[model samples]
Target chain A: MERKNLVEMVNIHKWFSGVCALRGVDFSVGYGEVVGLVGDNGAGKSTLIKILSGVYPPDEGKIYFEGKECHFSSPREARMLGIETIYQEAAMVPKMSVMRNIFMGRELARFRVGPLAYLDIPRMEEESMKALERVDLRLRSPHAPVDELSGGQRQGVAIARAMYFKSKLVILDEPTNNLSVKESERVLEFIRELKKQGISSIFISHNLYHVYPVADRIVVLSHGEKIGDFRKEETSVEEITKLMVLP
Target chain B: MRHTLLFTLRRALLLREISSLIMLLVVILVFFALSPLFLSRENVGVVLEIIPELGIVALGVTMLMIAGEFDLSVGSLFAFCPIMISLFVSEGIHPILSIVLALLLSLLLGGLNGFVTLYFGIPSFITTLGTMLIWRGAVLLISGGWPPPFSSALPTAFLVGRMGIFRASILWFAGITVLLWFVLERTDFGNWMFATGGNQVAARAMGIDTGKVKLANFMLCSLLAGFAGVIQSFRLETTLPSMGGGLEMEAIAATVIGGTALSGGVGTVIGTVIGSFLIRIIDNGLVMARAPSYWFRVFIGIATILAVILNTFVRERARKMRC
Candidate 1:
């Protein structure tokens, strides 16, 4: 069986001021594929994903989503096309309730009269709980602020939100960082669940152990360039780690 | 069992205005004990009448603060709008047209503030401070240090008419409060404001137009300040270049005392309403008790700090509670 690519970035290049961040890096993810993107700090993993997520534009390159070339001017534009990116330390609003954070930009309105509509609070609360349950995250109330939740729980909420929104490509940047052992296990499980549901995910992390079990393929970057791309069956953890640290 | 009680207490405090409400009651009682005239009809009327002038401005400031921005120029806009309205009317413009023109000017000034701040990435505190001085100087330049006489052709009954121990401005104040409260609590824009203020990076990642949200709030804050000034001018029948001079600080104080977070992303309109009343009552109560007028500022400073400490204490305890 042949799987079609859900996302394709050809020769993407990015620059900040006078410094080069990414130099002609090519990346792609197939439908229902979980790709582990690992790199050192400033390996341009965050920068690459930021460009794909429409946080900014690539200096040179073309992006094709579902076989169609697309340009996104803002994160909102990419979101409308079903690309949900959860950034490292940029997932949930700390002071907002779990339910509110889940429905932050795309709120459920009971009745909208030209941007003057009341929130469907009951529906949102119920839907958020169901979404959290899907990620196996249980809380006493959805109204509790995200600040009180553990790092793992916060990631759970972010994952639950992506699941609820029915995103085609969910990009998670270091979703397991600062998490306890149990919490990180839960997050890896979430990636497995996302694949089970036929959703493509790009999991960016620094830890190969965390990404190995869940990713179907591994892509390695070092100093703003791709050095290795291999199937999980062909590549061992040590091989990828060596490539990541290579001068 | 003890946990449930603590949970309930936390929920009650999460409402965010309870402490301010309690302070308001305490202040009322203290003044009532200190002076026989504390609750006199005239003194109560005076307090109620003036509260809306500042209350309306505070409402807008609360929304702006919740969106993680500031508008120190609101005080200047408060004076500038009315002065503009009076100038237009004297120039033979219809009274209604004059009011509309003044509000439009407010939005323009607000938009400029928002544009400069967001585009240049300057902190709103500095952007609005610069605009504050500019607008204040513009007002003085336009008015030439004298009050402008306002004789609107429109009926005074429509605006500040006496409504039996309350001026119509109180109704406007109440109406604006309800409108803004609904906008903040029940609407998508309100949620956006909270998310924007709560965490800009997170909000942006979630696909929110945080810049647009903050910009709208900046304009709204100025519009309300202008409208409140118009209301005041109608009551006074003149526009003072020095009107709303120190009002910006008072409005910010009201928001802080009402439990709105100084850092943004946490606030409530109802809390601000209570906060506005608390500030006005304290001012009126002291005067009725024959205390020095300077005591108002001293007392407000203390109350602001106490309210913040109380709110912080309650919030920290709530956060530590096990779910």
Candidate 2:
């Protein structure tokens, strides 16, 4: 099967002051595929994602998005290019409503009636509702403050927000870190839906079991080096675990 | 049938009270209980007048606070703004142009605070704290140890003072507050301010540009401070170097006591009004009751503590209920 590459990293070198965080790492995520990124605590999952999400530019490396090399000074620049990131603890504002969170930085302004820049609240509510529905959750109120939602619900909202924005590449960092069993399943199911939309994703997790079922290709990183990349049908969870722990 | 009944009972809650609304009730009750003079026609007029200026200051500080930032220089800026406007007006500059320039200058001041904080990655609290001192020094320098000739330039009936039904100051405050409320509750940018302060990291991830939000908030805060200064100059018919002395601390206290978390992400314009009223009433009552004027500070401090405790307790109970 032929796979089209959506993202490619070449010799990505990142350092914290002088200490090396990522050293000469190379990897690629294919288009329309769920790619798993597994590693230990210091395996540089966050560093890699930050570089990709434009949180921190790599010290030295080439990042190509859809066959063209690029560098982003900030997350907003990255987002404009259809790349979105959802960190475990930092994805949605707790005080903002579900619809506001869905639109957040990106909102559709209504036809300017006069001096006021009116928000198309009805349109936002409609869009947010459909986005929530895609995750199989019916929202009681579009105006529900995110802080009121439980852990599972918050995660659901985060995923839905990312999807609603029509991102081509959605990066999930430890998506189910603090979630319950059911919530984890909900996340997995959403990843499948992303597949149906042909939106590529990079799912980072400490747990190999969680990633295997959702991921089509598992890319194992240990101590910031790409150890192995294996197809789901070709590799078992045991092999992925052994590769992670042994390194 | 019993389970359904219990479920319905559990689902009920005190309608989500805007923190200010709840505080306003407490303030009215306490003031009314303490003094009959509080409800007098003259005192009512005083209350109405005072609430607006504080409301204007609160609206801007509310913006800064809601963005998870602080501005301790508003009082100083407020003093400086009117002095600048008076100076410009005295030079025969058009009042409208002078107003625009004053507003722009306020924006520049705010932008400077924001640029330093975001670019250097400094906490806004520290940046504003430093800026407040600097602005206060500048205000003193401009006054040249002499009070501004505010009386000569300002209108006694229009800008400076009022008679029977209306005061220029009251109208000024009301206009600003209405504009602020419209900006805060009716616009998308207003929503962004809340979200930015609520979770800086999350706002950034969502491409909300938390830096820009903070800058805008700071600018708005200073603009309000400046606007109030003009009205105050008119009211006092003078601008002393110490005109808006400690107004920053007062505005911040009012905001916090009104239920805005000093740490940011939760606050309201209405809440600040209640907070301002609480502090102001306490000031008036303490004086009427023959209490030490110094007690106002202590009362403000205590109110801050109570507001935080109340907020935490309410959140905890709400969490437990969910469980």
Candidate 3:
């Protein structure tokens, strides 16, 4: 049986200045699939995801989303197509309220006259609480700044934002880094929640232990090249770790 | 029960303007005690009249600061706009047209400042610093180091005319403050400003045009500075190249004292309004108390430092309480 692919990138190549970052990398995510992208430092995991998320355009390749060839010039354009990328340590504006952070780029305006419009604060607040509840995150108020939330909670907010936006694919780059043991568990649980909703995600991580439980398939990268792609049932954590570290 | 009490106290202290408000009250009380004439009607009116000039400028600076940028060139633009207005009027342009033209020039200069800062990837502080010198020199060259004669028959009464005990400029200041407050607190642009200032990387990753946001703020800051200069010139009926000299520092000080962070992403126009009044009152109170006018700078310096320290301490406490 052939699974339907939600996103497919074929022979993607990226170069920064004169240094090659990715060389003809072919990656794809199936419908309702979680792909744990594991690689060592400088293995091009981030570069590949950055290309898919529209942070950088691939020098040579094509991206097909839902069987349609797509071109993205900016991150905004990609987001408009139901692709949400949560970059590590760049998820939410710390000084802004949770509700504001949730609706940072897409705000609900009561009425827009020219460029001057009032925010629909009541509706935003109500929706924010509902989204947080979906992730089991209860706060005293939606007005509290995200800076006050714990590390795990911040990731929860980003996940909730992706869920609320009904994103077709969420690419999380190193989402579990810098989190405590318990907090990492919560983030893994979020990946499960995303999968339950039939939302596909690319979970990039250096820790195999963290990714093994949540990811349905594991893809290993070595120095800008895809070395192995295996279903979770057919691969072990030790096998992926060896592939990531082998020269 | 004790935790609830601590939480309430921390929350109150965490309010952005509370420290500045407390400082304003303290300064007012100390001045009133030292000199009974500090609260006299005439002296109060004098303070009110002077505050709008710097207050209006600070309001713009506060907005720009919240967007995570700085404009040290505002003082130069303040003087430059009015001089241009005077030059236009001398060239037979209608006073209204002259004012509008000068304002447009201000917007252009501000946009240039933003363009240079963002395009070259330089700090706005450095970018505005260079433009500050350039604009100041332009003012000197244009005005020839003297006050340009402004037309007294330009129907300026509507702008700076006296209404009972208050000048119309005061009303302008209040109106601008209210409008900007709404824009900052209730609008989508306001949220973008906070996000852009708070974390540029996060904002960009979220698909916001941080460069555009900063550019808009830069233009706005210069426009307000120019407008403030126009108000002053209308009141005085003259334009001086040296006018608003050193005013950029005063406006920055006012914003800092009002709890606007130097690092950006946190600030309020209302706090800036209180901050402006606080600075002016200190200046006027020293005169009323028969103290050297130089003490005004000393007091402002002390007030700015104290307000920041208090705000930081309170904010740190609130953060700890949350955990």
lDDT of 3 by residue, B54-80 (tens): 999999999999999999999999999
How well is each residue in B160-206 modelled by candidate 1, as lDDT tens digits? 99988999999999999999988988898889999999999888877
Docking class of 1: high
Cα lDDT, model 1, residue A245: 77
| lDDT on C-alpha atoms for all candidate structures | 0.90, 0.78, 0.91
lDDT of 2 by residue, A1-247 (tens): 1235889988899989788889889878888989999999898888998899888899999999988888989888888898988887788888778998888777778865554467888898999999999877777889888887877787778778777878889998888888889878888888888888889999999899899998999988888778888999999998888888893
Best by DockQ: 3
Extract clashing residue pairs from model 3. none
Residue A175 lDDT (model 1):
89
Q: Report the lDDT of model 2 for residue A222.
A: 81
Ordered by TM-score, highest first, the candidates read 3, 1, 2
Candidate 2 global CA lDDT score:
0.78
Could you tell me the interface RMSD of model 3? 1.0
Candidate 3 local lDDT, residue B135: 95
Q: Is candidate 1 or candidate 2 better by lDDT?
A: 1
For candidate 3, lDDT tens digit of each residue in A132-176? 898888899999889889988999999999999999999888888
Residue B211 lDDT in candidate 3: 96
Model 1 chain A: weakest 10-residue lDDT segment is A1-10
What lDDT, from 0 to 1, does candidate 3 have? 0.91
Residue pairs in clash, model 2 = B20-B271, B78-B225, B160-B234
